[model samples]
Target: MRRSERSMRPRRAGPVGRGDRGYVTAEAAVVIPTLVALAGLLVWGLMAAAAQIRCVDAARAGARAAARSESGADVVRVTRAAAPEGAEVRVTRGGGLVRVRVTVARPRFPVTLTAEAAALDEATVGGGGR
Candidate 1:
Protein backbone atom coordinates (compact mmCIF):
# COMPACT_ATOMS: atom_id res chain seq x y z
CA MET A 1 0.00 0.00 0.00
CA ARG A 2 1.28 3.45 -0.99
CA ARG A 3 1.57 6.28 1.65
CA SER A 4 -0.82 8.63 -0.17
CA GLU A 5 -3.49 5.95 -0.62
CA ARG A 6 -3.28 4.94 3.05
CA SER A 7 -3.62 8.60 4.21
CA MET A 8 -6.89 9.04 2.21
CA ARG A 9 -8.46 5.81 3.44
CA PRO A 10 -10.90 5.87 6.46
CA ARG A 11 -9.19 5.07 9.76
CA ARG A 12 -11.08 2.54 11.85
CA ALA A 13 -9.62 3.80 15.18
CA GLY A 14 -9.95 7.55 14.69
CA PRO A 15 -12.13 9.71 17.01
CA VAL A 16 -13.07 12.36 14.38
CA GLY A 17 -15.38 11.15 11.65
CA ARG A 18 -14.52 11.89 8.05
CA GLY A 19 -16.06 15.13 6.65
CA ASP A 20 -17.69 15.82 10.06
CA ARG A 21 -16.04 19.06 11.10
CA GLY A 22 -17.61 22.19 12.64
CA TYR A 23 -21.18 20.76 12.64
CA VAL A 24 -21.87 21.30 16.37
CA THR A 25 -20.50 24.85 16.30
CA ALA A 26 -22.54 25.72 13.19
CA GLU A 27 -25.77 24.36 14.66
CA ALA A 28 -25.27 26.23 17.95
CA ALA A 29 -24.57 29.47 16.06
CA VAL A 30 -27.97 29.28 14.35
CA VAL A 31 -30.05 27.89 17.22
CA ILE A 32 -28.85 30.04 20.14
CA PRO A 33 -30.15 33.35 18.82
CA THR A 34 -33.43 31.81 17.72
CA LEU A 35 -34.04 30.32 21.15
CA VAL A 36 -33.19 33.62 22.84
CA ALA A 37 -35.61 35.56 20.65
CA LEU A 38 -38.42 33.08 21.27
CA ALA A 39 -37.92 33.37 25.02
CA GLY A 40 -38.02 37.18 24.79
CA LEU A 41 -41.29 37.10 22.84
CA LEU A 42 -42.84 34.79 25.42
CA VAL A 43 -41.93 37.16 28.27
CA TRP A 44 -43.34 40.13 26.39
CA GLY A 45 -46.60 38.28 25.75
CA LEU A 46 -46.98 37.47 29.46
CA MET A 47 -46.41 41.11 30.40
CA ALA A 48 -49.01 42.29 27.91
CA ALA A 49 -51.56 39.84 29.24
CA ALA A 50 -50.94 41.01 32.81
CA ALA A 51 -51.38 44.62 31.81
CA GLN A 52 -54.67 43.84 30.09
CA ILE A 53 -56.03 42.17 33.21
CA ARG A 54 -55.03 45.19 35.29
CA CYS A 55 -56.98 47.50 32.98
CA VAL A 56 -60.11 45.39 33.34
CA ASP A 57 -59.80 45.26 37.11
CA ALA A 58 -59.23 48.99 37.39
CA ALA A 59 -62.28 49.79 35.29
CA ARG A 60 -64.47 47.48 37.33
CA ALA A 61 -63.19 48.95 40.57
CA GLY A 62 -63.91 52.50 39.46
CA ALA A 63 -67.40 51.57 38.30
CA ARG A 64 -68.24 50.00 41.65
CA ALA A 65 -66.99 53.04 43.53
CA ALA A 66 -69.00 55.40 41.33
CA ALA A 67 -72.11 53.29 41.71
CA ARG A 68 -71.83 53.66 45.48
CA SER A 69 -72.06 57.48 45.10
CA GLU A 70 -68.47 58.05 46.09
CA SER A 71 -66.94 61.41 45.26
CA GLY A 72 -65.19 61.79 41.96
CA ALA A 73 -61.78 62.19 43.55
CA ASP A 74 -62.25 59.09 45.69
CA VAL A 75 -63.30 57.06 42.70
CA VAL A 76 -60.28 58.19 40.73
CA ARG A 77 -57.99 57.19 43.57
CA VAL A 78 -59.56 53.75 43.82
CA THR A 79 -59.25 53.17 40.08
CA ARG A 80 -55.67 54.36 39.94
CA ALA A 81 -54.69 52.13 42.83
CA ALA A 82 -55.86 49.08 40.94
CA ALA A 83 -54.51 50.24 37.58
CA PRO A 84 -51.04 50.08 36.14
CA GLU A 85 -48.72 53.03 36.46
CA GLY A 86 -49.38 56.02 34.23
CA ALA A 87 -52.96 55.01 33.56
CA GLU A 88 -55.70 57.46 32.54
CA VAL A 89 -59.10 57.22 34.20
CA ARG A 90 -62.32 58.63 32.78
CA VAL A 91 -65.74 58.56 34.44
CA THR A 92 -69.08 59.43 32.92
CA ARG A 93 -72.58 59.53 34.40
CA GLY A 94 -75.94 59.74 32.68
CA GLY A 95 -79.32 58.06 32.57
CA GLY A 96 -78.93 56.67 36.07
CA LEU A 97 -75.76 54.82 35.17
CA VAL A 98 -72.11 55.38 35.97
CA ARG A 99 -69.33 54.29 33.60
CA VAL A 100 -65.63 54.05 34.28
CA ARG A 101 -62.84 53.66 31.76
CA VAL A 102 -59.18 52.82 32.37
CA THR A 103 -56.46 53.17 29.78
CA VAL A 104 -52.78 52.36 30.02
CA ALA A 105 -49.71 51.87 27.84
CA ARG A 106 -47.39 48.91 28.18
CA PRO A 107 -43.92 49.59 29.47
CA ARG A 108 -41.13 49.62 26.85
CA PHE A 109 -43.68 48.82 24.16
CA PRO A 110 -46.01 50.71 21.83
CA VAL A 111 -49.18 48.90 22.84
CA THR A 112 -52.22 50.43 24.56
CA LEU A 113 -55.00 48.71 26.51
CA THR A 114 -58.35 50.05 27.70
CA ALA A 115 -61.32 48.74 29.64
CA GLU A 116 -64.72 50.19 30.57
CA ALA A 117 -67.37 49.21 33.10
CA ALA A 118 -70.84 50.50 33.99
CA ALA A 119 -73.19 50.23 36.94
CA LEU A 120 -76.57 51.65 37.89
CA ASP A 121 -76.39 54.73 40.08
CA GLU A 122 -77.04 53.69 43.70
CA ALA A 123 -79.55 56.49 44.21
CA THR A 124 -81.54 55.30 41.18
CA VAL A 125 -81.36 51.58 41.99
CA GLY A 126 -84.46 50.53 43.94
CA GLY A 127 -84.63 54.01 45.45
CA GLY A 128 -81.28 53.41 47.23
CA GLY A 129 -82.84 51.37 50.04
CA ARG A 130 -81.88 48.05 51.60
Candidate 2:
Protein backbone atom coordinates (compact mmCIF):
# COMPACT_ATOMS: atom_id res chain seq x y z
CA MET A 1 0.00 0.00 0.00
CA ARG A 2 1.21 3.51 -0.74
CA ARG A 3 2.18 5.67 2.27
CA SER A 4 -0.49 8.25 1.44
CA GLU A 5 -3.21 5.53 1.11
CA ARG A 6 -2.19 3.99 4.47
CA SER A 7 -2.40 7.37 6.17
CA MET A 8 -5.84 8.00 4.62
CA ARG A 9 -7.24 4.69 5.96
CA PRO A 10 -9.10 4.74 9.28
CA ARG A 11 -7.19 3.79 12.45
CA ARG A 12 -8.21 0.58 14.33
CA ALA A 13 -10.21 1.07 17.56
CA GLY A 14 -8.37 0.33 20.81
CA PRO A 15 -9.66 -1.55 23.91
CA VAL A 16 -11.94 0.41 26.21
CA GLY A 17 -10.29 2.25 29.13
CA ARG A 18 -10.92 1.01 32.67
CA GLY A 19 -12.13 4.49 33.72
CA ASP A 20 -14.95 4.54 31.13
CA ARG A 21 -16.25 1.00 31.17
CA GLY A 22 -19.25 0.30 33.52
CA TYR A 23 -18.64 3.65 35.24
CA VAL A 24 -22.30 4.70 35.17
CA THR A 25 -23.50 1.39 36.48
CA ALA A 26 -20.97 1.41 39.30
CA GLU A 27 -21.89 4.95 40.31
CA ALA A 28 -25.57 4.16 40.20
CA ALA A 29 -25.11 1.07 42.31
CA VAL A 30 -23.30 3.07 44.99
CA VAL A 31 -25.58 6.11 44.86
CA ILE A 32 -28.87 4.20 44.97
CA PRO A 33 -28.04 2.40 48.20
CA THR A 34 -26.69 5.57 49.78
CA LEU A 35 -29.90 7.41 48.89
CA VAL A 36 -32.04 4.63 50.29
CA ALA A 37 -30.10 4.64 53.55
CA LEU A 38 -30.46 8.40 53.85
CA ALA A 39 -34.20 8.13 53.31
CA GLY A 40 -34.46 5.49 56.02
CA LEU A 41 -32.47 7.67 58.42
CA LEU A 42 -34.74 10.63 57.72
CA VAL A 43 -37.84 8.59 58.42
CA TRP A 44 -36.39 7.29 61.66
CA GLY A 45 -35.52 10.83 62.72
CA LEU A 46 -39.07 11.98 62.05
CA MET A 47 -40.48 9.14 64.09
CA ALA A 48 -38.15 10.00 66.99
CA ALA A 49 -39.26 13.63 66.84
CA ALA A 50 -42.91 12.62 66.90
CA ALA A 51 -42.29 10.44 69.92
CA GLN A 52 -40.59 13.33 71.72
CA ILE A 53 -43.56 15.58 71.00
CA ARG A 54 -45.93 12.97 72.38
CA CYS A 55 -43.87 12.72 75.56
CA VAL A 56 -43.99 16.48 76.04
CA ASP A 57 -47.75 16.59 75.54
CA ALA A 58 -48.32 13.72 77.92
CA ALA A 59 -46.17 15.33 80.62
CA ARG A 60 -48.10 18.58 80.30
CA ALA A 61 -51.42 16.79 80.56
CA GLY A 62 -50.36 14.86 83.64
CA ALA A 63 -48.99 17.98 85.29
CA ARG A 64 -52.24 19.88 84.69
CA ALA A 65 -54.33 17.09 86.14
CA ALA A 66 -52.10 16.77 89.17
CA ALA A 67 -52.20 20.52 89.80
CA ARG A 68 -55.99 20.40 89.73
CA SER A 69 -55.97 17.81 92.53
CA GLU A 70 -56.82 14.80 90.41
CA SER A 71 -56.07 11.44 91.97
CA GLY A 72 -52.67 9.90 91.26
CA ALA A 73 -54.17 6.96 89.42
CA ASP A 74 -56.29 9.22 87.23
CA VAL A 75 -53.33 11.43 86.40
CA VAL A 76 -51.23 8.45 85.35
CA ARG A 77 -54.07 7.09 83.25
CA VAL A 78 -54.52 10.39 81.45
CA THR A 79 -50.80 10.75 80.81
CA ARG A 80 -50.45 7.25 79.42
CA ALA A 81 -53.46 7.75 77.17
CA ALA A 82 -51.90 10.91 75.75
CA ALA A 83 -48.40 9.48 75.49
CA PRO A 84 -46.92 7.30 72.72
CA GLU A 85 -46.98 3.56 72.93
CA GLY A 86 -44.52 1.94 75.34
CA ALA A 87 -44.12 5.16 77.31
CA GLU A 88 -43.76 5.43 81.08
CA VAL A 89 -45.36 8.15 83.21
CA ARG A 90 -44.38 9.31 86.65
CA VAL A 91 -45.93 11.97 88.90
CA THR A 92 -44.33 13.52 91.92
CA ARG A 93 -45.53 16.06 94.48
CA GLY A 94 -43.13 18.30 96.43
CA GLY A 95 -43.64 21.65 98.21
CA GLY A 96 -46.95 22.64 96.65
CA LEU A 97 -45.76 21.74 93.17
CA VAL A 98 -46.74 18.82 90.96
CA ARG A 99 -44.20 17.48 88.48
CA VAL A 100 -44.89 14.97 85.77
CA ARG A 101 -42.37 13.13 83.61
CA VAL A 102 -42.94 10.99 80.55
CA THR A 103 -40.37 8.76 78.90
CA VAL A 104 -40.63 6.94 75.59
CA ALA A 105 -38.48 4.33 73.92
CA ARG A 106 -37.41 4.75 70.30
CA PRO A 107 -38.06 1.75 68.09
CA ARG A 108 -35.23 2.23 65.59
CA PHE A 109 -32.79 4.21 67.68
CA PRO A 110 -31.07 3.25 70.88
CA VAL A 111 -31.76 6.58 72.57
CA THR A 112 -34.74 7.28 74.83
CA LEU A 113 -36.70 10.54 75.07
CA THR A 114 -37.93 12.19 78.26
CA ALA A 115 -40.20 15.18 78.93
CA GLU A 116 -41.15 16.91 82.16
CA ALA A 117 -43.70 19.55 83.24
CA ALA A 118 -44.48 21.19 86.55
CA ALA A 119 -47.41 23.19 87.90
CA LEU A 120 -48.43 24.77 91.22
CA ASP A 121 -50.88 22.57 93.13
CA GLU A 122 -54.23 24.34 93.19
CA ALA A 123 -55.28 22.80 96.50
CA THR A 124 -52.25 24.20 98.28
CA VAL A 125 -52.65 27.68 96.82
CA GLY A 126 -56.26 28.16 97.95
CA GLY A 127 -56.00 26.33 101.27
CA GLY A 128 -55.59 28.39 104.49
CA GLY A 129 -52.10 28.47 105.88
CA ARG A 130 -51.50 26.24 108.93
Tens digits of per-residue lDDT, candidate 2, 1-130, equal: 9999999999976785855998899999999999999999999889888888989999999999999889999999999999998898989999999999998765634698999999999888858445
Q: Among all windows of ten consecutive residues in candidate 1, which has the lowest summed lDDT?
A: 104-113
Top candidate, metric TM-score: 2
* Candidate 1 ranges beyond 4 A from true positions: 1-16, 106-108, 127-130
Q: What ranges in model 2 sit over 4 Å off? A: 1-19, 106-108, 127-130
TM-score of model number 2: 0.82
Q: Quantify all predictions' global Cα lDDT against the true fold.
A: 0.91, 0.90
Deviation (Å) of 102 in candidate 1: 0.7
**Candidate 1 C-alpha lDDT tens digits along 38-114:** 99999989987898899899999999999999999999999999998899999999999999999886563568888
The TM-scores, one per candidate, come to 0.80, 0.82
- lDDT score at residue 68, model 1, on the 0-100 scale: 95
lDDT of 1: 0.91
Please give the lDDT score at residue 29 for candidate 2.
100
